[model samples]
Target: MSSTQVLNHSPFRLEGDFISQLLTNIRTRSISWTSFVKAGCLSNENMSVLKSITSVNDQEDPLSRVDVLIKDIPTYSKVLFDSILELSNNNTKNLDLTKILLVILYDGLTYINSELFESTITDEFFKISKGNPYPPFIEILNSTTSNSNNDDENNQDNFIISILTAHILTSLLTTVPAQQPASSLDLVSLLFKYIQINLITSNKLQYRFLGIQLLKELLSIKSFRNIYISHTEYLDSLINIMLDKNIELQMRYLSIYCLWTLTFDSKTSQLLTTNAKYSEIIPSMFKFANDAVKEKVVRLSISILINFLNTSINSTNKNEIIKKFLLTNGLTIIKNLIERKWSDDELKEDLNSLYELLNDSIKSLTNFDEYENEIKTKHLLWSPCHKNTEFWYDNIDKFKENNWKLLKSLVSLLSDSSIGDSNLTQLYINQSIICYDLSMIIKVAPEVIKIINTMGTKTQIMTLMNSPNSNVKYEALRTTQLLVANSL
Candidate 1:
């Protein structure tokens, strides 16, 4: 019933080989150079079957027909994955190539066998890896422009390059082993550089489509999210393009996708507020998503707000409400160290470090003294229920419930990550948490006294303040005096 569960089911639904065959067929025709491409493996018998269903010519409808053929793909490639990339390099100039690439990247993802997916077909289209001449798709597109007239070729060149880049990225997502960060990081880095340079310099409506491709690819990595944050300028271009009237919906959707990736990175959360352009830009997100762009942009905005909320320790009351909703809904990931799968001590040790980190994070959050009261009351959040809520105190129970669950989720992450820690390490980690807690208590103690009138006068306090550690007591006394003076 949840949105992710519902959304995930469809993407992973198609059969592996069937999807592969579709991808292969598309690739074969995608290249304008390849006259050798066949109708499809089953085209001889199914030619009539395919023709009746599609209303256009063989070339025009291949991409669209393939889309239809895929609903039943599970029947074919659910056994026949080899067929996906079997198409030759001729798939170079296909106009609708972008469509098929997205289809494979989206649907074929679920069925791909990691070993076969990676070893057989990954760089075949782009030819990037040196071992096999897996040159990137960019090179392939650039090659097309060589023999063409400059005037006529420009738009088509932009189209082909953008489409190819999109497909290349789609292939990466569809095939890359989701679990391996180390193997994937290098390619992701290369992709970020490609997208940044190509999309930024061109400013062409069609070229902006690469923004979506890059966003989807980068998000899949999850580990190298930092790379996204460091490149703030590229991100600004996306926010700007999202609103450009001349920009196509294709590119706008792509820009929206890019915005969602920005949400996952912590650094950019602040950039949304600190960067002057973002003040108005961020608000416009609500208007941008309607029935059309709604699912992508709306979910993206929620995800972005959650990132900002998660990073805030002393954020306003409204922040608490937002953070609470996100946590309750399982939007944030709590790091965990589940050991059911393996007994390796090394693995356990790594998990322990992860646990320590969770504790440190939780403690930091617990002790967060907070933010300005006025701002807490002023900032507003749009609610999925209807109009956005202007005041969080109006929904205190929801906030408290979410806060409680947030702590519980931290416990889960810690438990999952605690596999290797010996008692000593855990004890040491716990000590750090205790120290952090002391700091938190120290921060709020004076405020507590001011509210309760619990503190005695300084002279009365000094009479009883005989301590071995005079310096410690002196500091405490000085702190209390400052609190009292400020209260007055």
Candidate 2:
């Protein structure tokens, strides 16, 4: 699993009505605001049932819980959301109030319904669609007065504002439907400007990750993608980070995912292929694909190339760009990548898809006459394996290499708990593809089978054979058949 995937899914749902209830209960019972605010929602034992309700994973009762939260939360109306928003902006500069308000707004907005958001919440939180709603917090952050004793508190305040702002932006992107006018490109740009200034520009790595997290979310929406159509600065920043080896691994991976997101737009793709600076860095991305540390980055790097190729399919200058890509050794790189041991069938599918695209394009460009000659001469052979082997020798063998290290890398991936089960499924599917490919390769080159056995590859293959997924089992069986057939 990639860094982008890990951060995209929200771990907990925040209930608006529950928030309102806590405030109302505090007021009715004459509790002190400071004490209640300090206690926070987590400290209330009496609200355990409500907390439990919120704790129930949406996956367990998707229709019931999610629907109820969406429908019931709006009944409290904008009063709760507005109150929290106003408190966050209050001039008193009480750190406690700011903290509590930030907590409420961040949690509630993260999971609110879009219709509710557009109709009742936008004006209050954003001060009419065109205004800067975060000035007060930003003032505190930009202030030069740094007390040595309170430095930790000040840092905490900045971190809260950063996280809270990101969650607000993410909630808007999440709830606002693509067709709604509230999700205007201008509004997205305004919020992104804050993100760029406050989070992306910060020297702190935490702020960079948070900013990129919001970038990943916004680009998930097609309407929001228009914000980057003419604006290449975001693309430039993400690329710079991806190329920086000094940054944390997660930050670099998120940058790669952000670039992948932009490829969905033609303008971004055009800039990448036609723009001088971007075009220069295109080859370096392929090197990142072959990096030994993580398979996800390699998968993402190839996926980015695929997007670039897809974008070039129709352009008048398609051949020119294709020639550039080939000069970068794109064909040889992908062929060797395919030979790498994979833990996910989907990634293998991606590798195959890229190979197919590259192969078909190259054939269209170079083999038009050969194809015609084959038809005229009726020279095609009936044997499947023989022709396939010959094709590998002619085109693929020039890049031919063993993947003993790929096997070791994949085995290490099985123990990774960082990525969710969905990613694990992809890893399983990828392993299946590698097994199937190895089986076919062993048929033509029997010598490689000894290498596979020596690497203790059979143990891993048998483990895949026992997998519950039918697709994985079928591939495992086919691989076993090839291995046994060669030995006999």
Residue 237 shift from truth in candidate 1, angstroms: 0.4
Instruction: Give me the runs in candidate 1 sitting further than 4 Å from their true place.
Output: 1-59, 63-162, 179-186, 200-203, 245-254, 286-297, 316-488
What is the C-alpha lDDT profile of model 1 across 87-180, one tens digit per residue?
Answer: 2234444434333433443333333333323333343322323222223343443444343344764555344444444455445544544433
| Top candidate, metric lDDT | 2
lDDT of each: 0.41, 0.56
lDDT for model 2, please. 0.56
Reference-based TM-score of each model: 0.40, 0.52
RMSD of 1: 19.1
Residue 287 lDDT in model 2?
Answer: 80
CA deviation > 4 Å runs, candidate 2: 1-79, 108-159, 292-295, 313-316, 343-346, 356-488
RMSD of 2: 17.3
Each model's total of backbone clashes: 28, 8
